[model samples]
Target: MDHIRPLPAYLVQRYHGWRATSFAENRSWYRRLADEGQRPRAMVISCCDSRVHVTSIFGAEQGEFFIHRNIANLVPPYEPDGDHHGTSAAVEFAVTSLKVAHLIVLGHSRCGGVQGCYHMCSGHAPELDEKTSFVGRWMDILRPGFARLPEGDDATRQQALEFEAVKVSLENLMTFPFIAERVESGDLSLHGLWNDIAEGGLMALDPRDGSFHPV
Candidate 1:
């Protein structure tokens, strides 16, 4: 007697097709990937926004990028407490373990988390419901972005703060020892990106011009 594995019929069909493709491409592709380990060329810190997927935007093959996602794509300064430090752990693994050469901090337009941060900063922090809501707490990492903004109306200020959060996170990335070492030694380079999901626009910051250009 043989044990029967359980899986969705559609998934089983897809898996079979994928397995056939893999077998034709490389007979031992799974063995190779497992033995060789993940060798990603870049590490991307991006927002949890469903529309701003890194793999689709970058057209990267599977296992070609080390990805980390959080609210507003923040990189908090390294704190040596009992804090979970999920983002820090990802950065450490990408830099120290994977030795990825490139790092990208991605931001996007119309982000609900960024809007929530703006509302919290406007003396409305207490109004946010504490239960079943992690956005308020998760957005604390972007506090510096609000501080950097000039006093203005809600919409103007929120938009400015949202973009500034990307800069803040990029700055925070330097606080990690491994990241800083690699950046200073020219082993790693960091990039900032803004994806306008609604407009279908992809803009990447240009170091030479200090401006974002369409991709």
Candidate 2:
């Protein structure tokens, strides 16, 4: 608490602007959202990248999506060992409680986490290889994706791994019993997408070919 400080001037000013305009214009909508709670139709698992604005990309209004962001947008296999699992908990709440009809994994190009995993696997990032490195342990989830990186130039391989990250997460999501059950019953669907940050291009995964095509 002692270390906590007030919001930065820029962010505070932005908040004031938004509150005066957006919040004021949608006062009833905001009140209804608070009163009825969120009932989003989709759960988006995306990277914790400032550039990857999910709501803005989808033109989604408040309460339209239940989003969970993590490094590289990785989702580890389901392991109920009583440990704290933030991503898994969010998925559980979204699926079992919220009953989101769609679960989307959104990976992006130039992902720092994915790049770190790539370098770590290639033995170029020693710091990330340290036994006590939380990033290293977390990135272990992407090893399978790394292994699938196609033989190519640096840019191609990086983009390939980005797509693989989305694929790996979607695969891991199915490992959750509840999610698997829902998919089996046609109650939910899974999707994978890769975003090219610079060009604002989106590619969707074709499960049949295990390849990404422009969306």
Candidate 3:
């Protein structure tokens, strides 16, 4: 306890402001949520980038979305070799327990993780190639995506990798037996999306054509 510090001044101030305004206004709703537990209809997997606001984009209220954010928003194929699997556990809970109807993987333009992956795959970043680099190891999941990138400049190719991040995650998600069973039974659906951060434009993947269309 002595080693830990209190909340930063800004965060504390923000908490006070929220408690006075939003929390106060939604007192009853918050209480109901606590009493009844959550029943979110969808689970969204998004990037750890602060610019990617999943709740703001969808205008989601607290308790309305079950969100899981990570580097590159990647989902490794189901590997039950008894290791720490945060993303898999979250998915399992969302599908098998929460029974969320939709699972969405949201990727964005100018993602640092994706960019790192591009450089790593290009052999330009030897540091990230080291076994000790967690980001490097994680970005390995996007290697398949990088191998098939379209011919273009770095910017174009990077953006393509961003979309690939979403596609890879969508594919890996199906490797889960629970998710596969639910999808097969029509009880669950999967979606892949890409967001242009500065432009605020969204693109949805047409799985049939393997192309993204504006949404």
Any runs in candidate 1 off by more than 4 Å, and if so which?
1-30, 125-133, 151-153, 206-211
Instruction: Give lDDT tens digits, candidate 2, residues 1-215.
Output: 89999889999999999999999999999999999999999999999999999998999999999999999999999999999999999999999999999999999989999999999998999999999999999999999988988899988898788888888899999899999999999999999998889999998999999999998
Ranking by lDDT: 3, 2, 1
C-alpha lDDT (0 to 100) for residue 30 of candidate 2? 96
TM-scores for the candidates: 0.81, 0.98, 0.98
Winner by TM-score between candidate 2 and candidate 1: 2
Clash count for each candidate, listed in order shown: 0, 0, 0
lDDT accuracy of residue 163 in candidate 2: 86
Clashes of 2: 0
Clash pairs of candidate 2?
Answer: none
The C-alpha lDDT values of all candidates are: 0.83, 0.94, 0.95
- Over the stretch 79-188, how does candidate 1's per-residue lDDT look in tens digits? 86887988888998899989999999999998888888888876676654364567777777778888878777887788677677788888888888878888999999
Model 2 ranges off by over 4 Å: none
TM-score of 3: 0.98
TM-score of 1: 0.81
